[model samples]
Target: MFYERFTFRLIFKLLFINALGWLLIYLILKTKLWFTIAGLSFILITSVYTLYSYINQIRSDIKRFILAIKTRDHTLNFKNKSTKGSFPDLYNSFDDIIKTHKDIQLEQDAMFQLIRTILQQVPVGVIVVKDVKDDAEQMEIAFFNEAAATLLNVPAYKYWHRLKQHLPVFTAEIAHIRKGGKRFLELKIQDKLIQLSTEVIPLNLYGADYTIISFQNIKDEIEQKEIEAWNRLIGVISHEILNSITPISSLSDTVNSMVANKEYLNKEDLEDLKPALQTIKRRSEGLLGFVKDYRLIAELPTPELEFHSIGGILQHIHVLMQPFAAAKNIRLQVGQTSSKITVNVDLKLVEQALINLVTNSIYSLEDTENPLIEIDYRLEQNKLFIDVADNGKGIEPEVLEKIFVPFFTTRKNGSGIGLTITRNIMKMHYGSLEVSSVPGEKTIFSLVFNYV
Candidate 1:
């Protein structure tokens, strides 16, 4: 509808040109005058050429627009764009396209810079490598952050081979692993021993494969962690030994004074020594028991692997601990699950671990008004979890942190290695023990195993 005026103008111009050409031809045929014919022929050729140029103007403009787009020349613009012409909508469409493209590019560049800045600021090293175009054997470094260069203690190289020459071990690790993995490696780079935590990730983008390698120097971190762990362990051992020995040492002095006070009197003085002597014996045995429990946790045997029925384990634990729950009037509920669900684990060790958890749960429920313990299994995200949850006096955050420390206990009579041994057993079975507590609400201990 908008081209109506354009079409009318085009038809009028065609008719005028046809009429002028016919008039020139008629004069040449009828008059037979030489000068007149020559003049008419010149005028006719000029009019035809002028008409061809008028039609060709739009095609030339279109060609220029396409060239500009191909060259990414956003500055090329139609100087006299009009709303009225042959298909007037075409006048500014090319300019609009260039503007849109420029906007998208600007946004993309801004986002890329933002991401680059973040990578540069982070302490962890990040490098992005991709296969060369049409060359699978060669790789190009698409991204290398400041942290990566600093961590490796080398210049940021753009090509993979150059970088590989400097860090052969790290490069080999990234090259060999196709899928993602995390590893802790001790590398000797530039005469310095550095421990690195490296993680590799593979991604497919725009039909091209890329490898993202992230690493961090963890030597200092590992040393710090070891120191902290040792402090906690030594602290626990010292507190337990002192708690036992302090009373024993004081009582020994009192017994010596009593013996000296009466060298003659027999039964009465001996009777007084009996309580002190018994007290020393009791504390000594308690300390010895603490040492034994610590040894049990420190020297756990590797689990002998076997596939055991999940339901069977739960059934056995429920039957064994039912009496303890009955004594406390705590309802121990075993969730119903398919007997078909089984796990690859050491039956004895796993059973012992569960028994320890359930026993702890039983104790935790001692003072609650309505006590309950529930044991259940869930298969989630390719992992098998056996959850032991209790409605009881839940563990406090501070106590929970130290519960797995050997001989660290809140209960007066607790040996405190129960959770430690349980956790060790799970580790031996290639599983993990995890606990979450909500002080007044509930506590859950999850035995996590990789589902096969």
Candidate 2:
């Protein structure tokens, strides 16, 4: 409809001009006057020029509108001055289209800003990667947040090829994640455990497919779960053993008292019964002590958190263990990396934990020549660590895994609860105990405190 309207108007203007030209020609021919011809010629030329200028003006307006749209200059407005013609409506249409496009562009920009803000604020590490189609070994890191760089220990704008050199474990894990159906994994980097979850979005965004990877630190969560399981098991075992042992202890005492009384048995009967009764009494008492240790494990008190000087704590431990160390001619020494270091912990519990580690070290050094037990405290990466190191016969690998289990002990007379209690104490303080040993060389037990 618009095309037809424009074409009809153009044809009418051409026909009117043609008629005017014919009139001018007839007047010139009939009058045989040069003045009349000149006047008509001027009028005809003026009319033709006016028509050309009007068409050129419309062409200029169209070119300006195209340029404004191409440049995204939505502020440009086309004014309709001629209210009597279709040019007015054409100008109005152009203005409306430009306004609509401006609104759409503003909305899109706002949406993009919102998305970027959300991605930046999220705690979990996120990285978006796009696989290259032709180059199998090349992958582009399209986006990565601050947490991603910190967690991977790599630059935020690194390609997969370079990232592999910095974090081979992470790159290898991510490669396996790209294979279908594996979305979660636990990776250890720089002695810190990280839990990773990946999602392959399979998005055809701007003609490419991309994958989004996410990472969470779940080490604390796993440790909490293990602690809960240990508590429950200890609770049940302690309850049952106490119930059985209490009655046996009482009965053994009663039987022994009766056996001691002459009226309770004859001489021969007394001789045979006394040893058996003594055995029963001894075993029941031992069982009672064992149950008590398990109960302690199950009912470990919550830490009374307070900040104490690391130097003071280590000095106390060294003094307390000196006599025992000297009895075996073993040298026990304590030192610190810094004199002003402090730790937040339960004083009694943390001391006990350290005592257990030091005692274990002392015991391990009994047979070695020039046996030494070195106790030292140091600050590393904002963490406080107390190490009990010994040049002793270190633990075997097979025994190391079960060392923390309750009632698992290598020493014949050990109650087997010392290390277990130490571990529990560390956990109560939101800390951890780590041990490293080399057979016939050295053993180091580190009590790591995360408190500032």
Candidate 3:
């Protein structure tokens, strides 16, 4: 009803303007009078001007609304809110439109600032750039974070050419892989050697090509890891050497005392000497075995890569170890798998790793009531995992931590190098060997093929 009333008012205004227009024209054509015509002409001009002003008000308001948005001036407002006011809906709509646009702009600005703050605060150096010329050397740096400057020990560079001059060798490596990849670089900074781990990523955002280079100074991290590795190796080696030498040292002194008191051994003395000699022989052999294991773990060979069906490999291991499990009355279950599932890995190395895991499971089941070992494959997040799981007395948490540490063992006569050698083999194949165990329920050792 309100809109109908407004439409009616517009019609009335148009009719009034038309009537006055005809009247003024008729007076000019019929009378052509001097004083009366002048007075009537003035009224005609006033009526036409009023009509134009009334219609033009809407057009003028539209122009003002657009100008407010163009200039981003939020202060501009339509004051009339009552239904009685002219074009009340138009005024209300303008206010709502401005508010919506203002909110959208605010949200975009806030998001951009949040990302900027995060990138600036991160420890990894970052730089986003776009190629201005054919070569990457002539590039424009779009985003250079604070970490970039700090890690390089240089001022923020806005162009690739400027940065190239500052760190020529580092820049060269970056140029080599403008597409995308990762590498570790050795560099000298202020007469000190540092290792830098760097990566590049290429992207096309909103029809513009961009490259983001992220790097970090990993010298301290690498050095710290090396120190920890040395400490572990030395500690294990020392412990093993002492364990063998302690018994032999004490036995040697007793045997020597016996010899010093006698010219030759009588039957009683000879029997005593035999057992002591046997102990010395056993300990000497144990020490020699430990050295061989040390060499095996330290000198792991590079994996020979080949694509092999996962089902085939698992099937082979089952056939080979079935007898060993059968002897202990344990079930060796190989899970059903897809024939198409395969991985790029060394056949011998992977088989060896599985054998080690299965052997450990077999040993764990010696005292358990109903023992079972399950071999299976799982696909997760674009990677394949081959698992050897067992239901036996599982590994304890304290021992699990050191299970991969070379020469660290929980069982008597355990060389303890099996797991370490297995882990090294997976590393050579760009994969990983992982374990998880519950105290009394289950233990799972996964040989994860990550790169494949």
Candidate 4:
């Protein structure tokens, strides 16, 4: 519609000027007069100037409209009193387009603000790292929330590349995450334990990869678990002590009554009294041993942390369990994914933990044909893991839950304090003991060590 109206106006102006030119030529030729020539000259010059000015005005108006839109000048009004016919319609269309763009811009800004507010209010820390467009190896911190700044002890405005100077381990871990490495990590930063997770979302914001990392401080959760575990331990200890003490108390009372009635007792009664006395002695000794084990759990020594070879630890464990593995006909093997991998741990303490795990694996393999116990170590995302996996009668789900509780045992004549002590040793070295099992299939126990 706008084009048709513009064409009609152009054609009308051209035809009107052509007719005027024809009339001027006719008068100049027919009259053959000098005065007519001067008059026609003046009229033609005036007509040409008017035509040029009109065309220039239209061109200028169109240019102004485009400039206003390009500069996002919403205050410019295109409605003009001099602009008649279809020109006004063209001007109004331009104004409508500018208004629509402004409305969309406002909506987008509001949505962006809302998203930013939500991210800041979330409990978990959020960090967005974007690769630098100019430097392929460099990365910048595009956005980070208050929680992220506080948890990382970094200014929200600082770029990630600058963190290498003060927080090398953290920076390296983030790089590892961005490279599609490990997805989850539990790290000790300063004195706080943080559980960090990452999600890589490919963003074409500037033709570069970006990663979003979320982390939370899990120290409180761990402390709560420790409290619950202690409560369960207390209950188990109480039950075990009562079981041993109740029998001793009744046997002692029987012996006392038999000795007190010496005049009424026969030879057979004397033999029965002797057996009751021996039973009491055995129960007393058992109670004493139980107390000793409980003391051991309470007095676990602090680890003397140092770098230790993973291969050496596994070799020592393999030798220690050689006899037991042979007796059970279990194939015990030790392997590592890398020979250079090492762990910062207390050699004696970690060795003890590994031995306890291997022994448990050995015991589980009893009565199973062609049982296998594999001890393997691997390094991942700046962390080390020593895994003891066994193909045997796996642990029951109910029993697995209480395996870490002190004195909670599923085995006959088992002390049940071994796993408890092993876990404590791991904790001392700034590591953790994790276990997973499938009944009648397999069991895997992982010793996670933070290498940093």
Candidate 5:
């Protein structure tokens, strides 16, 4: 209230002083009696105006300072060069303060930008959560590259899935792996299996923890292990073949020399020699058959391709096996014949495979009463399916896994290259041969082929 009244009184005094001073100057110039009084009054009024203008300038500078502080820019200086009195020192001090504040702010901004650049190029998926406990935790996902997306099987645009929905089971598995100190955990989703590696590190601020997860595909590694196993088995089989054949050939030569020399002269010796010679002959024949089967495993034939109707091919197999089925008191039937189902296959190789399958079925039916073999073909969805089903004593689970393996057999005189050769031939034709069996019920062998 006093400031307002002072301003009003100052304005009134200035107006009245100006009017009275002008009147005095005019009268003094006219007469020269009160010239000194008018000069003194003019000087007093000029001093008051100068003081008022200086105070108002100071007020305006203070308001500008406050506005700069509200905008968080402390680098604005107050410049009042016209005031060369005691207030010059105050204005210079405020300018120095502004310079100091500007330096501090610049250093802070530089440090923030440096940290941002480091996080942006960290080469890992870095997620920063500002508040760990609250639900409104601000999350920033950064530094996910193309390789990371491919490894994780996540699309580039859609890197984040709700943790529970995409891999609920696998997330639990990953947690278990983390607790156990395992480097990675493999999990299957659809047709793809990914290995996830997780790590927990302390956040730089507020003593919180953040988790980082990395993903990789281990399917190629699994395939490499399987190939190594197969190669090792092949090496062992080759060594065994060498060991068996070297001694057999030496013994056969020794027996031939003795028979040529006719070393036994007594009647008892001759009688014993006859049975011995017959035993040797039978053993040699069996050993020779074994060698042939082993060679067949080592030297598989390349498929010779030909195009033929699948129905006619199965019909030919049925006719070829009529005698064997009849001998075993088994009925052979073929059905579901499609007229135009054709496949590019090695006819000779496929025929041999079919013969092997049918022969195995017949052999399995020795003790079965009223056994029957069915050979059929069908064209469904542009693929040819040939099925060979038999009602016989089915194979055990343990034996089924080894059925396609070379020199693995359950039969008394089985050479065991039959199924191995069959599977190889089907693979050469770019088809697949699958077998399913129950313990005492039917056994099925399905040959699947896609039309070319």
Candidate 6:
């Protein structure tokens, strides 16, 4: 205000002085006019200094605004008191915008923190993948808690790419369930069987599609199932074996008593007695074999761990079974893995289990044009899984559940001890044997060893 008024005063003073000079010129008409020129030069100097000061103030305000933005202080304001003629309203509007954005940012931060807290507290694995919009991709990982990180094996800085490869199989499965709108799925995760549930939602106010996959470990459930199966098996075997043994013992004792009585002996009677004795003997032998099979389960041998390569084992088995398979016109193929893997296992027991599996596979391949048997091994999450698969007329779904039980057979001439003994061997080694079959497609017997 002072500078503006001074400038106005100086202009007026210059006009007055010029008018005075003109008046003098009109009256005196012969002076040099040096005093008027000096006064005008002083005015010009003062105007230049004031203009430089105003320019400096404007520059400083601009620098402050930039600094505020860099420091994330969006609410910072610069209302230039010196900028004259209608600028306050504009500055006020700009400040309002900054305040609004700052408020939004605070709200967003709060929401993220709350979500993070919930995820960290969750017991089950919680995996999240956010959609990347610019590339029109399905999802990327926006957040992963500790449980999720360990479950998915996600490493720092490589999370996005890792998620890209793995999450789709889970997401697609989840999406299918969501289409039906089911809440849960029985799944296998890292050698541990589990049930997983998923929810699709938007993340971070950006409308990125996020999937939350939560999984419950079902290891205990599977253990319970195995226990139930064994309990039922024991009950049936005990009842049936006792029933057969009681009558066989009683008949043998009666035959011995008749043979000892000389007074009742006759040719016709002796002939009938001989047939009866022989029938009893044959039944006794059959019962003994049955008891032997049953006792194998009761007297299971403890496993002695030995390091053995699967490839060598399979190669040896393939050679041993080659002639048998060739006689039956069956082709046995060994699938290769990345490298040779040595596992701590009982060699004899594992071999016996695998032989039973291969035998079962061969028996199932009756009517197929090309009976193909495949033996493959894989390492997932540091667990070794050996799969014996066959292209055969697979077992019916209704009977698939009972295939592992002792003495349960659909075949006419089968003792049904192969798979039962196989399961026992796996149990001794603290491993699992799982059978999956689809009619007319394939039957897979997966022997899993999670020691490593």
CA lDDT, every model vs. true structure: 0.84, 0.79, 0.86, 0.80, 0.69, 0.71
The weakest ten consecutive residues by lDDT in model 6 span 177-186
lDDT digits (tens) for residues 83-119 of candidate 4: 6545667777877887887888789989999988999
Q: Write the per-residue lDDT of candidate 5 for residues 1-452, one digit (tens) a residue.
A: 43464467667767766776777677767776675666767776786787588578768776776677667677576565424533565667667766777787789999978976775555443333222344422333333445544554554332223433465775465455432232446677677766555443334444754445444455577679779758755764675566565656665675565568675567765674676567666666766777788788668788878788877887788779998899889999888455566788888888998999999999988899899999987667646778889999989998887787677778887877888888877878767898999977999997777663
Prediction 2 TM-score vs. true: 0.48
What candidate 1 gets wrong by more than 4 Å, as runs, is 1-71, 81-87, 131-136, 159-178, 190-193, 254-275, 302-328, 339-351, 377-385, 423-433, 448-452
lDDT ranking, high to low: 3, 1, 4, 2, 6, 5
TM-scores for all candidates? 0.75, 0.48, 0.76, 0.60, 0.47, 0.54
RMSD, each candidate, Å? 5.3, 18.6, 5.1, 9.0, 19.7, 13.6
Model 6: per-residue lDDT, tens digit, 1-452? Answer: 44465467557756665665565555444546667555655655565565566556656755775676567688576455424422445456556656777888899999989988988777667666555657635346666677766654555222455554665665556665432232445555566555554444334555545555566554577679879987978876776677677777787787777777576788877886877778777777877888887887678688899888888777777777778777789998877633477888888888888888888788889779889999988888646889999989999988987887788888877887888888888877767898888889988998988644
lDDT of 6 at 330: 95
Q: Rank candidates by TM-score, best first.
A: 3, 1, 4, 6, 2, 5
Candidate 6 wrong stretches, greater than 4 Å: 1-227, 246-264, 337-339, 379-384, 427-430
Clashing pairs in model 4, backbone N/Cα/C closer than 3 A: none
Candidate that beats the other on lDDT, 3 or 6, i.e. the better one: 3
> Following a full C-alpha superposition, what root-mean-square deviation does model 5 have from the true structure?
19.7
**Largest TM-score belongs to which candidate?**
3
Name the candidate that leads on lDDT.
3
The candidate, 1 or 6, that scores higher on TM-score is 1
Q: In candidate 3, what residue range of length 10 has the lowest lDDT sum?
A: 79-88
- Regions of candidate 4 where Cα sits further than 4 Å from its true position: 1-112, 123-227, 261-270
Query: Each model's number of backbone clashes?
Result: 0, 0, 0, 0, 0, 1
Instruction: Give the TM-score comparing model 5 with the true structure, all chains together.
Output: 0.47
